[model samples]
Target chain A: MIQVKELLAILIASSLVSNVVLSQFLGLCPFLGVSKKIKTAAGMGGAVVFVITLSSAVAGCIYQYLLVPMNMEYMQTIVFILVIAALVQFVEMFLKKFVDSLYKALGVYLPLITTNCAVLGVALTNVQKEYGILAGTVNGFATALGFCIAIIILAGIREKTEYNDFPEAVKGMPMVLITAGLMAIAFCGFAVLN
Target chain B: MSKSLERLYNGLVKENPTLVLMLGMCPTLAVTTSAYNGLGMGLTTTAVLAMSNMIISMLRKVIPDKIRIPSFIVIIATFVTLMQLLLQAYMPDLYKSLGIYIPLIVVNCIILGRAEAYAYKNPVIPSLFDGIGMGLGFTVSLTLIGIVREFIGGCSFFGNELGWFAPVGIFKMAPGAFFVLALLCAIQNKIKIEGAKKGKDVSKIQSGCNSDCANCAIDCEKRIDDIEITQEDIDSTAKINAAAIEKELAAKGGEK
Candidate 1:
């Protein structure tokens, strides 16, 4: 019953029109904190994309197969969080064991991903929108891609502006925030696509 | 002041989670579209924070250090779910407005950060007050930001329109949150600069990763030592580098 056109629309809408960081404000912490260098930003973004997409698929299956049948939908919050924490741990171990290079790049960020609201936000949003498993997984990927795009852009901007002279009050984080506001305004222009 | 009162003071002013320490920016930015929404989110977080802090403090002795982070998360998520159900039953409007944010509270850095920094190490009463203090500080900042945004963006105060100039309309949207917070942080910096000029020891008024606990992403404890070493010997580059190398070895000594 779902059309390819509809899926494309979902993908575009989630990624560009309603970006996770710029518009929805889901993952502002990582967007701000780990974005000092483009290399690290891209690494963090890659880790997020991997974790969110996989976790969404897993969370969707668990919800649809287990929670719904039991009529314990209210327990979604706790269940999803525990699942995410465990999943992050599992992903960390897997990466460390199988791909040591990637583990080196993403080791520190892996632990922090457990507390990143975007992961939990995507899961809860999937439930709220009543998407099927496939749709939910796609939405999760799109949302995380949106986050990746925003963080890379911000990191690029920050690196360029690192040495620019500014007033004392507007030197550090305040400047970054102001830049984010302007970026949000720019992203707001994408609403026309909706 | 008593130890509990000092903890309260610390959470409120010395190390406020939002403005000062800059933890939990997601809810602060997303839910502060209006004063009422800000108050609701802040109070809900307050409830979760206080109760979880108390419980975590009680169980600090039992929870193994290796698994303490997961244990803290489970405790926080339980309270958040309970709050969600209570809000859904009694305050449906706030519940709807908050939506995904309610459940998202589990991953909020403030609760977990406080658990790691204070609750796990402190006693029950001080931890409880620390939670209440941080909660109130968060509530105050959110409400302040909400009032400012609502006043400008809506041309109204707390949903009551004042026949003033037309609303900017942007203040109510996503970008408005960033601009307002940016402006507030700038103002805070301006005050800190003025205080430093007057020789009031304004060293603690830092931005970004300079905070004691910073955000959940950056481990400020490790960075703090680096900061101290650099400040002590800016000219002795070779010495500082050697010291940093030594510290890195020390830190990684226990690991495989």
Candidate 2:
């Protein structure tokens, strides 16, 4: 049981110091693919936030109560993936029924979230770091927000680059990767703040 | 000489998972900060990929259709955890540097994508070769990127000090990563386009490894290997398209 202050620290650390995509490379697929369009980026970000938080919270508890007690901690990866896959399914249904607008924006990307790696990455990291339930959940939520921030910023940049006249060879994917490198350099500035 | 050898050739070049197929970008980018790190990650991934492909191929028929993806994930996660323990016990330094990536292999697209697209459908021998070919392809690209970054950024090649040009420093940084990878890709793309002008197939060297597995489409190139993707094979492979195919075959009565 972490205090409120420590929880905030974990959140900030995950969202910045160790960003899931930019620094850690946990969820580069959605980062590169969805970052092409702001709308899809936001939609995918929303789904990630939902699924990662819910799954991590549940995974933390399972690790704490079940795996720890049973000494089957080695099973963390398999167990967390199973939870995440199931949680993603539930979140998909919940979004379609309750948040119809979000449903449409993120409908196609929801299933993809199951295999996004970031979600499972968080769950496993939380276990590896030995964070308690509440702390792990906060870290997971913050990591997804970090992903959200990175993708939206990349999308905004990409949207502007659409009109520029890049060299023929450096036009599409190559240019985008170069842009990400620059963004990563800029983000590295945050390392000082920590 | 044989179909198995063709599969190996296809994986190494024709359908190189890293350079051409573009699967598993996360590790390719994050871990390639140093040549030694890159080689360690690449070899670890290769071992897991080869073993998992063999196991998955052997048990392909046993796994139920409705729960294939989850089952595959379970299998992959188990292998990854096993690798993690082995690495930690033997190579603690490498394991420490690799950190979370070792476990995150559970989500590496190459392993899952190959298991889904090739291993699950093909026989055990070819699938094993496909895994090796693809794994070797990934290792080669990763080591290449690692060598470039290490030499340019740190003034070393495979950890040996070169004592040559001044290390630019940024070449080892994240932006440098993007630059080197982009440079390689751009050159490959240029060659491919130029090759196409000569009526030569350059698809094999077109692009670098990209992770497109989480939401892979039915027509993903990885799925359609050198083995011509017939309608029946496509239907069996893609769950999303299976329904549509059922309705189509039902309506068309063996027409397509």
- Score each candidate by Cα lDDT: 0.86, 0.82
lDDT of 1 by residue, B1-256 (tens): 4998988888889988788876788898999999989999999999999999999999999999898877888899899999999999999999999888888888888888788888999999999999999999999988888998898899888889896899999999999999998987898799898998898977666554333232355443243336446756676977889899998998899684
Candidate 1 residues lying further than 4 Å off, grouped into runs, are B209-215, B218-256
Each candidate's DockQ score against the native complex?
A: 0.63, 0.51
Clashing pairs in 2: B18-B209, B22-B209, B22-B210, B23-B210
| lDDT, candidate 1, at A21 | 93
Separate clash counts for every candidate: 0, 4
Q: What does the lDDT come to for candidate 2?
A: 0.82
Model 2, position B44, has a per-residue lDDT of 94
Lowest summed lDDT across 10 adjacent residues in model 1 chain B is found at: B206-215
Off by over 4 Å in 2: A98-101, B203-256
* Cα error, candidate 2, residue B220 (Å): 11
For residues B1-256, could you state the per-residue lDDT of candidate 2 as single tens digits? 3978888788778777777766777888889999999999999998899989999999999999888888888888888999999999999999999888898888888888898888989889998888888888888889989998999899998889998989999887767877887787788778777898999976556353334354332222233232334676777778768888888889899675
Task: Evaluate model 1 with DockQ and give the value.
Answer: 0.63
TM-score of each: 0.89, 0.87
Assess the local accuracy of residue A170 in candidate 1 as a C-alpha lDDT between 0 and 100. Answer: 96
